[model samples]
Target chain A: MRIKELFINNFRNYKSLHIKPKENLNIFIGDNAQGKTNILEAICFLLQGRSFRTSHEKEIINFDSEQSKLKTELKAYNQNYSIDISLSRTKPKIIKINNSTTSKPELATNFGTIVFTPDQLSIIKGSPKERRRFLDLELASFYPQYKYYFVNYQKVLLQRNNLLKELKEKKQADTFDLLELWDNQLISYGAKILMARMEILKKLIPMAQQIHNQITSDKEKLTIRYRSSLNLNSNFREELIYDQFREVILKNRQQDYLKGQTTVGPHRDDLVFLINNKNITDFGSQGQQRTIILTLKFAIINLWSCELNDVPVLLLDDVFFELDSKRQKYIFDLLNKDVQVFITSTGMANTEKNLINIKKNAIFNVRSGLVCEEEL
Target chain B: MRIKELFINNFRNYKSLHIKPKENLNIFIGDNAQGKTNILEAICFLLQGRSFRTSHEKEIINFDSEQSKLKTELKAYNQNYSIDISLSRTKPKIIKINNSTTSKPELATNFGTIVFTPDQLSIIKGSPKERRRFLDLELASFYPQYKYYFVNYQKVLLQRNNLLKELKEKKQADTFDLLELWDNQLISYGAKILMARMEILKKLIPMAQQIHNQITSDKEKLTIRYRSSLNLNSNFREELIYDQFREVILKNRQQDYLKGQTTVGPHRDDLVFLINNKNITDFGSQGQQRTIILTLKFAIINLWSCELNDVPVLLLDDVFFELDSKRQKYIFDLLNKDVQVFITSTGMANTEKNLINIKKNAIFNVRSGLVCEEEL
Candidate 1:
C-alpha cells in the first residue's frame, strides 16, 4: 500500500497543505511543534476515519475554521483509491471513499495502517486499559468483524453496568431477570471478542518472539499472553468460553450489583509481555521494553504481509532518533522493498544517514504550518 | 561530586565487579540485559540505600548468591566519603557511612545523586501516584527532614484508613473520636508535605521553563503546577494550608467511611505539566513529552547547584540515543565541567560521536556482568 498524494485544509496546524509523497520513503523533518506530527496524523485520519492524536474531533479542526478537510490518493493491491474526510465542530464526520459515502469501519477495511509513536510506550508502562486498547485496535485493524463484536460488547457492558447501578439505587431484587438478559448479550459478544483475541495472539506471539530474537541477537526470549477476566483453561472453543463467561457472570452478579458495575468481560482483559519468564513491565529495563514494542510492531507488519498478501502503510513518528543505527538498519531490512514508509524527525539525528535506499526517499521541510518538498 | 571507586559483589548478573570511573564522563556500553543499568542502580543504592529499579531488595542479589554488597568512594563538597551497603534475601539492608552505621535518609543527605532512566518517563505519563512520588523523592533528596515528615504522613494515612475500615465494619459512631485523633496527625504531616512540595515547585517550575525554552529554541513554554487535594490559595503559610486540609478532610470523612479508604491528602496530590497552557500528557507529542522530562531533570540539576552549591552525580541510562545531537549538546553545555556523569548505552549509537569533551571521558565495555575500562 502507498499514498500517492495527500491534501489537507483547516486541520491542526496545517491551514492548507498538499504533496505527492515518494513511493517508498517520505521523510518530514523539522524542529519540535513545527507541524511535523500533524502530517502523520492527517494520513492516519484519512485511512482510519478518525484522528489518532485526540479523541475529541473538534480539536483537529483549525481554530479559525469550523471544519477540516482531508483527502488522500493511494494505491493498494495494485488498485487506486481516493479517500476524503471532513470534520466539523458540531456535526458528525462525513467520509467519502471514491465519491461514495462510507462508514468508518468500511473505510478501515479498505485500507490498513500501522502507526508507532512515542506515546505508545504506554502499552508497557501504562495501565491495563492501555494493553486492552492495543489488543482491540490491532484486532480491529486486521479483522473488521472484530470491531463489530468489540463495539457490541462495550455497549452491552455499559448497559449492564447502568442496570446494576439502577438496581443498587432502588434496592430492587426483581431486576435480576433483566440483568440476566444483558449478561447473555454480554457473554455472546464477549466470547467472540475473546476468541478473536486469542486466535490473533496465537499467531502474533510467535512472530513477536522470532523478531525479538533477531533484534536482540537471541540474548533474551519474548513471550506475550492473554489474561482474560474469565477462567480460561486452554480452551479455544467458543461454547466453552461462553459457558465459562456465563458461570463467572452468574457468580459475580452480587458483587457487581454491590459495586454498581460490570466486573467480568473482554473489557477487563489485559496483555502481559514477558522476557525469559520475567514480566517486562515490572522487571525489564527501559531498553528491553522498547525492544519488545518494536518487535511487536514489526511482527504485526510481517503478519499483515503474509496473511493479507499486502502490507499496511507504515507511520514512524519521531521514533528513529530513539533507536540506534543498528536497530534502525534492522528495521529498514525488515521492510519489503515496496512498503511505503512515512517518518517524522527533528532532522538533526543520523536517521537520514541510515536510509537503506536514499534514491527512493522524498524529503520535506515543515515550519509554522507550511510545508515545502526539498530536492533529494 | 565524583565517584573514585565502585565495588560490587553478587549484584544482579554481576558476580563481582569494580572500577575507578573518570571525573567528568563515564560511559558504559553494552547490549540489552547485559548489566549496564545494574551499574547505575548500584550507585543509586549506595547513595539512597534502596534499589531504584525494584521494591524487592532480593531481586538485586545474584541468583547464585544469597546477598549483595556495594561500596563507593566519592568526593562531594570538598569532603571525601565512603559508603557501603549490603543486601540479603532473608534480612534487612545494612548501610554504613564512613565505617559508621547510618540510616537511608541520613545517607541520602550525605551524598546527592540524580538518576535519569527511561522508566522515569512514568513521572509524566503515569498515574497521579507517580507524580506524587516525583515530588516526594526530590524533596526527600534535598531535605532529609522532608523524609521524616513523609514517612510519618504515610504512617498516619495508613492508620487512618485502617480505622475508617474498622469503623465501617463495626458500625460504630463512637470511634469517630479515635478517627479524629488520626485525622489531626494526618493534617499535621500532610500540611508540611504540601508546603515542602509547593516550595520546591516554586523554584523548579521557573528553571524548567527557562531550560525548556533553551532546548526548544524558545518555541514552547513549560509550566508545572501542583494540584493538591486541598483547596489552597496563594498563601504559603503552613497554618493556612493546615486549615484548608482540616476542612477538606472533615468533609471527606463520611465518604471515606463509606468507601473504607482515605480520599483527601498529600497522597492524592498530582503534578501537571503544561506546554503553552496545554496539558502535555494529553496534547503534546511524544517528542514534546520527552523534551519536557529532560527539561525537568536539567532544572533539578540547576536547583541543586544554586541552592546546595554542589551538583549531584549524574546518571543517565540509555536516554542519549533518544535525543538528537542538538538537544544532547544543550544538555552537555548545561553541565558544569567539574560534574561527574555516568551514562549507559548500547555502544552502537552515535552517542560516542557527540561527546563534547573527549579527553575527560572514560569508556567501559560491559557484557555478561563484566566491565572493562578503555583508555580514551
Candidate 2:
C-alpha cells in the first residue's frame, strides 16, 4: 500500500501543493513551520479523514481560507484508491472515496496508516488517556468495525453519565432502573471494543516482544499485558464479558451516580509493558520506553501485513532526527524497499548521510507554507 | 560545582547505596526501574533538598521504610559543600547545609543543576501549565526570592477568587470593596513574579536564538516572545506592570466571579517561539521544536555559567538516545570538560560510543533497586 500522489490546498500553512512522492522514502525537508508536517497531515487526512494535530477543523484551514481540501492517489492491494477530504470551518469534514461521498471514520477499515511522533515515544510514561488512545486508534485502523462499536460505547457512556449526574442533582435514591437501558447498550458496545482491543494486543505482543529482544540483544525480555477494568479472564465469549460488565456496572452504579461519572469501561483500560516481569512504566529508562514504543510501532506494521492483508504506509514525523542514527538504521532495516514511507525532517543532509540503505529518495524544500522539489 | 560523592537510602526504589562519582562524566547503565533515576534524584535531593520527580517527600521513601536520607559531598569554587536532606513519611523534608537546617527552597539559589529529559523536549508543545511550571522553576532556581513572591501571589489569588465567588453568591454589590485588600497583595506579588520571569526570558532569548541558529545551520532564526495576559510591552517597571495588572484584574473580576475561576495574571501566560516570525508552537516540525528545546536547555547552561559564577552539575536523564548520535555529538561539543555530567542509558556500548570526547568516565550497572559500579 502506497500513496502515489498527494494534493493539499489551504490546509494548514500550505496554500497549494501537488506532489508525486517517492515509492521508498519521501523526505520533506524544511525549517520549523514550513509545512513539512502538513504533507503528512494531508496524507493522514486522506487515510484517516482527520488531522491528528487537532480536533478543531477550523485550525486546519488556511488562515485566509474558509475551507481546505486534501486529495490523494494511492495503490493498495493491486488496486488504486483516490480519497478526498473537504474541510470547512463551520461544518464537519466531508470525505469521499472514488468520487462517492462517505463518512470520515469509515475510511479506517479500507485504508491503513501508521504514524509515529516523539509524543508517541513518551506515551508509555504519560497518563492513561494516552495509552487508551493508542489502543483505540490501532484497533480502529486494524478493524474498522471496532470504531463503530467504540464510538457507540462512548456515546452510551456519555449519556449514561449525564443521567447519573441528573440523578445526583435530584438526590434520587431509587433511580436504579433508569440506568438499565443505557447500561445494556453500553455493555453491548463496550464488550465488542474490549474483545477487539484484546485481540489486537494478542497479535501485537509477540511481535513487540521479538523486536524488543532484538533491540536489547536478548538481555531483557518484553511483555505487555492488557490491564482491563472488565477483568477479562481469557474468556472472550461476548456474552460472558457482557454479563460481567453488567454486574460490575450495577455494583458501581451507586458510587457512579454519587460522583456523576462513568466508573468502568474500555475508556479506563491500560496497556502495561513489562521487561522481564518488571513494569516499564514505573521502571523503564527513557531509552527503554522509547524502544518499547518502537517495538509496538513495528508490530503495527507487521500486524497490518499479516492479518489485514494490507501494508500500512508509514507517516513518520521526525523519525530521522528524533532517533539516534543506529536506531534510525534499525528502522530502515525493518522496512522493506516496497514500503512507502514519508518522513519529515528539518534538513535533508542528515537524512541522506544517515539513511544509507535508501536506494530511492525524494527531497523537497518547504518555506512559508510552500513546497518545492529538490534533487541531490 | 561537581558532586564528589552521593549517599542514597530508602529513596524511590533504592534501599542503601554509596557511590563515589567522577566529576566529568558518570554513566548509569540499567534496564528500566533499576534505580538509575533514583541516583540522579538523590543528587538533585542533595542540591535542592528535594526531589524533582515528586512533591510528596513520603513518596520518595521506600515502601517498607518510613524515612529516607540523601547526602552529597560537593566541591565548588575552592570550597566544599555538604548538603543533607531528611525525608520522612509523616513530615516535611528537612534540609541541612553544613549541619544548619534551612528551608528546602532556599537551596535553589546557591545550588545549580540543569536537567534534560525526553519529557522536556516536548514541553513547549504541551499545555500552558507545563510552560508555566517551567518558568516558575527556572525563576525559582535563578532567583529563589521569586518563589517566595509567586507562592504569595497564588495564595492571594485563591483568596481573591474565593471572595469574588462569595460576592456573586450573595448578590452584594457593596462587597466589591472587600476585594481591595486581597487585590493589593495579588498585584504586589504578581508583579514581582511577572518581572522576574521577564528578566530570565530576556536573558534566555539571545542565547537560545544563537544556539538555535547554530543547530539549524543558520537556515532558521529563532526568537522567543513572552506572551502575557497583561499585554506587557517591554516595560520592566514593577509599579507600572502592577498597576496594569490590577486594572485588568478589576475589569475581569465580574466575568471571573461568574465563572468561579481566575481569568488573568501569570496563570494564563505563555512563551511563544517564532522561527523567522513564524509561530513555532503551531508551525515547528517535531525536529525543529526539539532543537528549540535543546537550544533553550543549553542556553540555561550558559546562563548559569555566566550569572551564578557556578557551572551546574548536568543531570541528563537519557538525552543521549532521545537525541540522535549526530545531535549528541553537537551537544558533547557544546559542553566543556569542567562541568560534571551524569547520564543514564540502558546499555554501556551506546554511551561509550556516542560520547566520544570524554577522557574519563564511570559506568554503573543498576538492577533490582541496587547500583554496582563497573569498569568501562
* Number of the top TM-score candidate: 1
Per-candidate interface DockQ score: 0.28, 0.24
Give each candidate's fraction of reference contacts reproduced. 0.27, 0.23
* RMSD list, candidates in order: 4.4, 5.4
- Each model's iRMS: 3.2, 6.3
Can you write out model 2's per-residue Cα lDDT over B1-376, one digit (the tens) per residue? 9788888888777888889887577888776546777788788778766666666566678877999988888887668988889888888778888898988656866786877766786577888788888878777767868878988888988898888777876887566778789888888888899889888888888898887776666878888888899979686788788888988989987777788667889878988888877777666666667677778777887888888777878887755544434455566666645677888865533444556443556777888777787754
Displacement of the residue A182 alpha carbon in candidate 1, Å: 6.1
Candidate 2, backbone clash total: 4
Instruction: State the weakest 10-residue window (summed lDDT) of model 2 chain B.
Output: B349-358
- For model 1, the stretches where C-alpha displacement exceeds 4 angstroms are A63-66, A151-187, A227-235, A243-270, A276-278, A347-355, A365-376, B127-129, B148-187, B227-235, B243-270, B347-355
User: How many angstroms is the interface RMSD of candidate 2?
Assistant: 6.3
Instruction: Give each model a TM-score.
Output: 0.85, 0.80
lDDT of 1 by residue, B1-376 (tens): 7899999999888898989988787888876667899999999999778877788788788878999999999988889989999899998999998899999877888776888887787788778998888878888766668988999999988888899888987887555778889989999999998888888888898889998888877878888888878888877789999999999998887899899999998898888999888888766765677788878777887888888888888888877555555666776676636678888876534553556466777879987788998655
Residue B103, candidate 2: alpha-carbon lDDT: 81
